[model samples]
Target: MMGNFHIVSNNPMVAEKYPDLTEFEKDSKVKDIFAEGRNSIHLGANLINHPLAGSIKPNQSPYKSLVMSNEKGELDMFSLKLIEGALQVLKKFPPRGIEYDEQTLEDFQVIDLDLLDSAIDSLPYEYHE
Candidate 1:
């Protein structure tokens, strides 16, 4: 039943009649997708940092206490930047509406990925760690 309608059609009347989705919702959707992307990248990061991970004490899995001595550290910097960029994207395209609903996700699609990608790419390749 949900898929019965022409959601993305150019029909002016249909678009006019349908409930409008907000920019905030659209931004939220992008953030959700970006988060998923960040997670996937983190998995890759974990693999890439396997050697460093191995060095950590077995009792300490997630390094919350990693003290960066005068040197730069090898951490989840890439993932951090990805999330930051994603947040910035949402801010740049803040939801035009005050709130969101289930239908909002269905009503929107990613219009741009360049901004988020650039943020992620801007992070340094390696740190002093």
Candidate 2:
């Protein structure tokens, strides 16, 4: 459920849609988001969705969003490994050197939000209770 999760993202649309649930890092890069999620995982939070979920390559999108459990307990090894691997894979792709126009940037934000929404929608019904 929405209340059980935390959103780490640089996408403004996601923050706007779920302000209370988001850890909005307006200036963070994709790797920054992944690293933040990894840090949270180290603190015992689990990943609710893959960091690299969509078809858009890491280098292609300027915005990234990750959903993680709000509850902290024993460290989640799976989440830690996943986020760490994502960070490593991200290092392989060079940054998008080309500057995007405002419209293109907004489109990227929409795509990131859509992926996050999909993950939320796929959660089991009991989690929403």
Q: Which model scores highest in lDDT?
A: 2
Please, what is the whole-model Cα lDDT of each candidate in the order they appear?
Answer: 0.30, 0.87
**What residue runs in model 2 are displaced by over 4 Å at the alpha carbon?**
none
TM-score of each: 0.27, 0.93
Candidate that scores best on TM-score = 2
lDDT, candidate 2, 15-112, per-residue tens: 99989889999999898899899888988899989889558888899999999887899999888888888888889888768899999999999888
Clashing pairs in 1: 23-95, 23-96, 24-95, 24-96, 72-129
lDDT of 1 by residue, 32-93 (tens): 53444344445443211111122322122111111111222354665457455644644565
Per-candidate clashes come to: 5, 0
Q: Which ranges in model 1 have alpha carbons more than 4 Å from their true place?
A: 1-28, 45-76, 88-93, 98-129
In model 2, the worst 10-residue window by lDDT is: 120-129
lDDT for position 75 in model 2: 95
> What pairs collide in candidate 2?
none
